[model samples]
Target: MGDGPDLIGRRLREVRAWRGLSLRATAELAGLSASYLSRIERGERPVERRSTVEALAGALRVAPTELTGRPVAPHTPGESEGHAAVEDLRGALRDIELDAVTPESTGGLRTLPELRHDVDRAAAASFACDYRCLGAVLPDLLPRVWAHAGRIDGARTLLIECLFHAFYLAKDLGYRDVGWSIAGHLHRAAEATDDPAWVAIADYMRAEAMVGAHARTRALEAVVRSADALTPDAGPAGQAYGMLRLSAALQSAATGAVDVVPDYLAEAADISRHTGDGNFGGQHFGPRNVAVWRVAMAVEVGEIDRVPELAEAVDVEALPLGRRAWFLMDVGRGLAAQRGRETVAVDTLRQAEELAPQLVHANPFVRETVADLLRRARRDAGGRELRGIAYRMGMGA
Candidate 1:
């Protein structure tokens, strides 16, 4: 476990930030005191309990397999850099097997054996920050991961877990074809695994991809199915259900479900509040999760007065720099919309558009928001900068 605690801590921090949960909020939800969790993040303390590790993994929306080091299977022609980093990982696997028959074996040995072969090829792509690889590998990876689902190994669970996130990134990167492909694979994987959590997560991903494609009615139905699939018995499945509900509500509003807009936004906010900060194992919904979407919805429905308050409640400083910049620009959009300040909107949206490309795997909504704002400003400018962004997104003005 040399540097194991530190590596785990770093991964935990990255996941938390990616999901947009603050330390205090995550602490409250994970049922660990904030100070202790802080120490864990700082690598001053190692997570010693299986329950603790599992809880943290859940919050992170990762399987316990990832926390303990294991070699995930490869999905490429060349050996990946990530695999090279764990030169000893395969040796570690053999050692685990030898120690398994010994009474003096540590718990880490048991965990690794179960997780070793369940490696996610998508993890490799994500680690490399190669969206092109992600697009190429992840589309094929999900089926390969699920192919072993019926096998008596931990890989099945780990693969599906990784698949959830891989698909999400695909959707974010505007690779909806890959995203939907992964989602469809998950549908089969969940059926084989008998895990409603998997089914719900897959369904949610499907809905999200549909939204990205602008198939509003299909997205709503996918989300509704996700919500219906969530049961109290589902555990993490239930949490995933909540994710779909929020996504559905937000998308519904985005697509002109005017009557449901306020209630859906309110419900989404309430769900975010009730779920606390650490519920997803490190993947909980917070302001950065649903609230970000809600604020966008608010803008769509002309809830101008609430925008400032909502913006205030969010930890804007903690968000990824690019997103924080976008949020600030969004605030400016709301203000400009209400006051009809075309110049203000133009300036604010310009700042956001400049920062947009910096945001890797950005949600389509961000582009759409900027598009709408620029389009409005274009009316005043008689169509100049707005056309530029439209060209970038391959839209006609």
Candidate 2:
């Protein structure tokens, strides 16, 4: 469905970026040139030499095959009938002609003989995770995808998306490395797709993972780069809104760039409002969605004083349950700053802790921010009460 060259380029860029290597650095490490690598991403140059691909993949710590979206040729029967839909969808995702993805002419995008093998391998690894099998999945999936490097149309995008979700699922289930491994592939997929905006998005998410690792400076840089990459006409409104929200939140959290927070929030709000219910690419951001994210950003920027105003400015109660819980966490955090006494902090934090598990989905910043605050408060006060709260939230005693 998706073109092989485009898919390979995207995967290559994603892997290289995730490894944090500059084009020059990657070239030096892999014995390639920065200019040549750029040509590959732009799809002006082809990486047909397996030695070159293997070297690049090795440098990026990805298997060579993962860079190539087509691992093996599709079965004739699979290609002709039932697999038409899958192939078509894959083509659309690949955007084989460098134009916008459309419903028509999207089939037969994947012709890579190698990528097919890796897909089966990655899928098998993903399924093996059901048995709490991190070791099996990691070994089965990562290497194959990494080694089979090249463009195979929409397969690259789909594969990386699957990998990201798989890793996230593994992380939520308490396997951190699996999540990290999946996240590691985001950059390559974005690259092979030849979309700068998606590259920025992948970087932003990578930075988010770094934040969880407490790599604040790296996270901040990632967010700023993502924001910088925005070209106004990048894509649909919801995508832009999500990026804006992330940029502002990360800016505020990572650098104390508090002054920019309001502007960022306002920009995201404006986009959401104008977009008319966040319907971008068939996805909706809804009023509640924007408001909840805004609240979280406001809290992170120490704009706690503005929390009430923002809350009143939007309909918080009308949001999704996950979002409502997030808002409650924000409100709880904001209430912690009240002048009266430490009692308010304790009470508010308790609510935050109570609402935490739900907030963890789709919002990592809230969890990290709350955890850090609770840890600091406990250390500052040396109080059993604060320590107990952190323990209950699994922030680790």
Candidate 3:
């Protein structure tokens, strides 16, 4: 949906800023000229090839999907059919069985190596926000992954891992039903594997998806039950566990249980001391991630002043573009909510729009936030850009 060249340019700029990188520094790191980088950020240059996108993502410490979005062809049967496809996909998952899945499911040789290759690529696609490709591929991918649902092989374990990312794609797309399906599959896979860390991840994602439903109590129960799933010495698995704990804290903040939020935050902070910053549960979880969550938590509690304070303590640039962009959205929102900060807030939102246009545009909360800004904004100056975004989201009536 983000077809304009400017969308990509804005992402380049927003992510660069999040990482605390200057235009000159990022250009040097990506082996491009400052002028070109600036142009790309300004939407003047056409986007690059996958290799170039990958290079830029690497230099910026983000997944390719953050920059490229879904690599949809002109005729790709997505966007228009996304809602229906989700329902159809759910039906497929509902009917799957270990006995039913086999070599034929893959349309060719379904060897472990080949299947894993596809699984990895699918995970990458989810990170890249290639929803159309992911939606197109999942009908096949799910069955193959489900084939080993109860097995304890590496593939079986990876099934949980793959499902983890799959759930992410679903959640980001606002298909919570699909996310719950992914979560159910992961729960079964984690139970099958009997792996502590994987189990922690399953519990974590469950809590994550549940928060969207405003089932704070259910989400709280989930993380609490997984409390002993891993220790700090468990490496990424432990970090994953701690990350879930942090998620629970965010959930508490959402419920306005400010008193309980700090306990969960403290526990997660302890876990982060061991793992620092890491790619756990396909999400960034570390001390800095904890700090980032604090900003979001502050926004959740309507403590706008605290949001910027917490934000400055964490350098978002170290996060992947997807995560970095998400964090910035909160910052932008917090700024927008404060008196006399509407102008800065609009600029912040613009940065967020550039980083992940669909994520910003498709989210109802963000739309409402922008709508509120519009109601309060003046007619001239920055209002023009805000109005343009409102029109795209079909909001500024």
Candidate 4:
């Protein structure tokens, strides 16, 4: 978050000038438009994707990390506060045993109605990838919901849904231990509730965590099992089924089963046609959501060129902020994969970062890509700027 935008731009311009290439020539080699590269070099914009930086490095005949200055050495200490916050949350979870929360100790707990409103707010914060906002609420929310869950008939299920969202937020913030812990708690909550749909939803969250963690085989298997477990009946169940199928297809795509993604998506589309799009109490299923996942699949399977076209067809602004940011990152990835598109890719990635710094910055996927770019970058201004980013990320420059 330091010096928000200018650092990468300076590095880009310096490298281009040092290479003794015209903007048009450099753009052509990098697969970026001349005008776009010109704007970037002139400090009119910033870069946010490692892929775009990689592309530029390729054009410049330098290592990707040379531009970013992120050394392969171990990072410096005391960087991100997220590490501390995650540890605090972990300790908090340990201190309060979910089983120990009884009905008798709910004297000062927030009412169910109030907690419901808080969950909605937390969900919105997650959609926006506002980790700071999410952190503020979850510490109190998690314990309160579990502490008073026994007294209310429907509260346990409601709280489980809240826990699902909390798990999702933690995963996005790169707090894997916290995320997995929350997932375990959620599964326990699902069991306690004794509801089929809730159980399926918990399974879905678990699968999602696997996929995010890059456990391709296990993720695909889990999604498939969950997809089958869901009954295609009316209401939220059908929506959950569709989402589960879509999730399976995405995992399939990741595993080079590109053909399976569309088929599964088609089936999901049929279900969503009737059930419509909306989070059926944290299911987050719908045609629109399917469309977003399609972009991701297309990128995953080497059909990088198709991503932007698909992304353009969808109204990304209409989606939730987190989803929108996620889509933009992929679009940038796709563009970076092609010739004459790196500049546009940079713009897309920057837009994504503006939408959600937590999703863009804290993501291991994103940071790894950035680190790779830095390692391959040349020893120049670009490399120095990249190193600055790496240093801030707790990785040495």
Q: Point to the candidate with the largest TM-score.
A: 3
lDDT of 1 at 350: 58
> Each prediction's Cα lDDT score?
0.53, 0.50, 0.68, 0.66
The runs of at least 3 residues in candidate 1 whose Cα sits more than 4 Å from the true structure, single-residue gaps closed, are: 1-148, 211-215, 232-238, 279-283, 318-397
List, residue by residue over 270-308, the lDDT tens digit for candidate 1.
655555443342235554656565556666556767876
lDDT against true structure, model 4: 0.66
Best by lDDT: 3
- Model 3 residue runs over 4 Å out of place are 1-78, 81-85, 97-99, 148-152, 211-214
At residue 144, give the lDDT of candidate 2: 35
Clashes of each: 10, 50, 4, 26
| Deviating ranges (above 4 Å) for candidate 2 | 1-153, 166-181, 212-215, 234-238, 241-245, 279-287, 314-321, 336-397
Question: 154-248, model 2: which lDDT tens digit per residue?
Answer: 55555554455354444433333434444566666777767665565566556545422124555666566565666644245246445546555
- TM per candidate comes to 0.52, 0.47, 0.75, 0.71
Using TM-score as the yardstick, the better of models 1 and 3 is 3
Question: What are the RMSDs of all candidates, in order?
Answer: 19.9, 17.6, 15.4, 10.4
Ranking by TM-score: 3, 4, 1, 2
